[model samples]
Target: MKAPDFDYLRPETLAEAMDMLSRHGEDGAIIAGGQSLLPLLNFRLAGPERLIDIGRLAALKQIVDGDGFVEIGALVRHCDLASSEAVARAFPLLRQAVGHIAHPAVRHRGTIGGSLAMADPAAELGACCLALEAEMSLQSVRGQRWVRAVDFFAGIYETALAPDEILTAVRLPRRGPDSVQIFSEVARRRGDFAIAGLALVADNHMANPRLALLGVADRPILAEKTMALLANNMAAADQAIELIGNEIDPAEDPAYPPAYRRQLVRTLLRRTLMELLP
Candidate 1:
């Protein structure tokens, strides 16, 4: 299917893109790599009157290391993140998660900000962001604001972003020396959307770990209680599984039934915890 008629604008500057978005409001959609939006447009699931393409905005395509955080521009592609030495060194969870997203071709065109903004429940980036405790930099003609990952995703395909706002960057806190990271997911076939996935980042000594699950809920589900359970008694893996199953309300989908998904969560949680072992 071909996309409906729409006006396209490739703005060279961030201000220009913001102006176009403000003018078009809900009728306009932001296109980064077009990896996700183009398919939605072709399927007629999204019909926008205007498209604000920020793919050419070089200012939005950088990855920089801050004192305590790593900043990734919204336009940074998955392939870039996967290959980045800085990302590999400081954000192993993100690098590992990006390596599993779709495939090489898709990674070349998929942007980190686009995936998070889309808020797909089965996306690795969303789950990684939650586990990393990342923050997003949002901008609009009005002003700019930062949103924590915990507060950014409202539901599946839903976010805190307004129609005229754009996500410009994502900030991930650098893992400390004692941090251990793990990421695992199961799909029907390689490169397919996950049936279930898990990402875990913990400082065992500090007893603060972030446990997040995907493909088991409407949005990426942050399992604070499950993390606490694991931290308290890493020996009792069954307790972690039971806590996750009882806490997360997974949806029934064609890929897997709700019961199967709950079981997957348990299995993945156990495996991830095992990976955290010294």
Candidate 2:
């Protein structure tokens, strides 16, 4: 189905985009790469009076390397991240995960910020950002604020992004000297949504372990208990798996039920520990 009648706009600057969004308020919807929003619009799931396009804003397209993090612009595409030397150096696991998001065509058109803002449960970037403890920059006409990845995601298809706010950039932590990262998923097809996915980032000695689990809940969830177990003692892998199996609250689907997904999660967790732990 075609999208309903709506006003289309392309703002030249971030300020202009903010002004348009503020003016339209609830009637406006932000569009960057249009990878996520266009499908929603086509399905009639989202109908807005104004479409604020910020794809032309050059400032939002920049990638800056900071002392401890890479300041990745919100408008950066998935394919761009996959090929970016900066991204590879800072977050190689993220670069690998980006390659698994949908297909090459989708990656070419999908913006990193758009995927994060959409907060899809099975999205690889959000889980990777969480595992990497990335920071998101939220801007508005009022002011700007930074939100941690752990707090930015609210629920499935939801985030801390306000009606008048825009996600400007993401601050991804640079890989440390002893950093070890891994991403794995069980998808029916090579480019399909993951049935169960996980992203893990930690040091060689299991210090500061960060594990993010996806496709088993309403949001991409940080496995705090499991991470704690890994941090305290990697030998408690079985116990941690049991804890996650009990904690999982996946939506009931006839084909892939909660039990199956939880089992997948357990398997993935075990495999991750086995491969990474010395």
Candidate 3:
């Protein structure tokens, strides 16, 4: 089905986009790469009265290295992240996650901000951001604010973003020494939405690890309990699987049953931990 009729505005600057979003309120939606939103529009799942396209807003398209973090413009595409040497060095998990997003063509057109804003529970980007403990930069006519990844995702296809707020950037902490990262997922086919996924990051010296699970919950979720288990026995693979299956709530869908998903999560979590351990 074709999308419903709607007015379109391509803003050249952040100020212009915010102004348009403020005026339109919930009737408007921002379009970055249009990879996700366009499909929703075409299916009539989303029929915003106005589309404020910020794909050309240069201010929201930059990737800057900071003292302790990297600020990535929301409009940066998956392909950009995959090939960026800076991103690769600072956050290899992000690079790995983006490469698994969909396909080369989709990665070329799908923006990091778009994927996060879409908030698909099965998307690798969402899981990676949570695993990295990234922060989201949100803007509105009133002002700007930052929301941590743990707080950004509310539920399935839901986010903490206000109707008038546009996600402007993602801030990721710089990698520390002895940091090991792993990302793995099980999809029915290459580039398909994952049936189960896991992203893990550990700093052996710090003795802290972040475990994030996807495609098994209402939203991408950080497995704090699993992480706690890792602190005790970084080599206890079975413990990691048990914690993930017992603590995390797996979603049941036509694609997979809850029991099956739990088992897949166990398998993926084991795989992720093995890759992250020495």
Candidate 4:
């Protein structure tokens, strides 16, 4: 199906884009990489009155490694993040997870900001952000504010972003010298969206582990019960594995039932723990 008729506005600067957004309010949809938005439009899932193109906003295309953190601009492509030396050194979990996103052609055009803003329950980047405790920068005519990854996602295809705000960048802490990262997912095929996935980061000896799971709920979620159990005592792996079923509320899908997803989550947790703790 073709997209409905819409007014297209291309903004030359970030400020201009924000102004346009402020004026259009809920009637406008911002398109940066267009990898996600185009599909929604093509399927007639979204029909904004005005399509605000901010793809050429150069200010949101940088990868800045700063003191104790690395800030990735919204327009940074998935493929670029996968191949970045700074990302590899600081956030290996993200670099590894990007490989599971989709085919190369999609990755070449998909932006991290677009993925986060879309708030897909099964997107790898959103889960990685949660594991890393990344913060998103949201800007609008009203002002700018930072939101933690855990609070940014509202639900399936929804976010905390106000209608007039744009997610400008994401700030992620640099991995400590002794940090260890792990990423794994279960999918019907390579490059397919995972039925369930895990992104974990921890200090050496698996202390202070942060485990974030995707495709197990309405949005990517931190396994707080599991993390707390492991944090309190690494020996409680068996109990922590059991806690996941209680923590996650996965909806039944036609292809994958809720029981299957819960089991997959358990298996992922078990495998990850064995690799990290054994």
Clashes of 4: 0
Model 1 vs. true fold: TM? 0.96
Clashes of each: 0, 0, 0, 0
Badly placed stretches (over 4 Å) of model 1 are none
Give each model a TM-score. 0.96, 0.96, 0.96, 0.96
C-alpha RMSD in Å of predicted model 2 compared with the true structure: 1.4
Q: Could you tell me how far off, in angstroms, the CA of residue 269 lies in candidate 4 after the best superposition?
A: 1.3
Residue range 62-96, candidate 1, lDDT tens digits: 99988999999999999999988888888888888
The C-alpha RMSD of each candidate to the native structure, in angstroms, is: 1.3, 1.4, 1.3, 1.3
Q: Write down the lDDT of every candidate, Cα atoms only.
A: 0.88, 0.88, 0.87, 0.91
Clashes of 1: 0
Pairs of residues at least 3 apart in sequence or in different chains that clash in candidate 4: none
lDDT of 2: 0.88
Candidate 4 lDDT score at position 161 = 97
User: lDDT by residue for model 3 over 1-278, one digit each (tens)?
Assistant: 89999999988778988999999977888888999998899999999998888899888778998899999999999999988888988898988887678999998889999999999989998999998989999999999999999999999899999998999999999878778888999998899999889888878632678888888888999888878877747666677788788887775578688889888888887776656545
Q: Give the worst 10-residue stretch by lDDT in candidate 1.
A: 202-211
Tens-digit per-residue lDDT, 1-278, candidate 4: 77889999999998999999999968999888888898889999999999998888999999998999999999999999998998999998988899899889999999999999999899999999999999999999899999999999999999999999999999998878988888999999999889999988888776888999999999999998888888847689898888876688889789888888888898888888888655
Per-residue error at 115 for model 2, in Å? Answer: 0.3
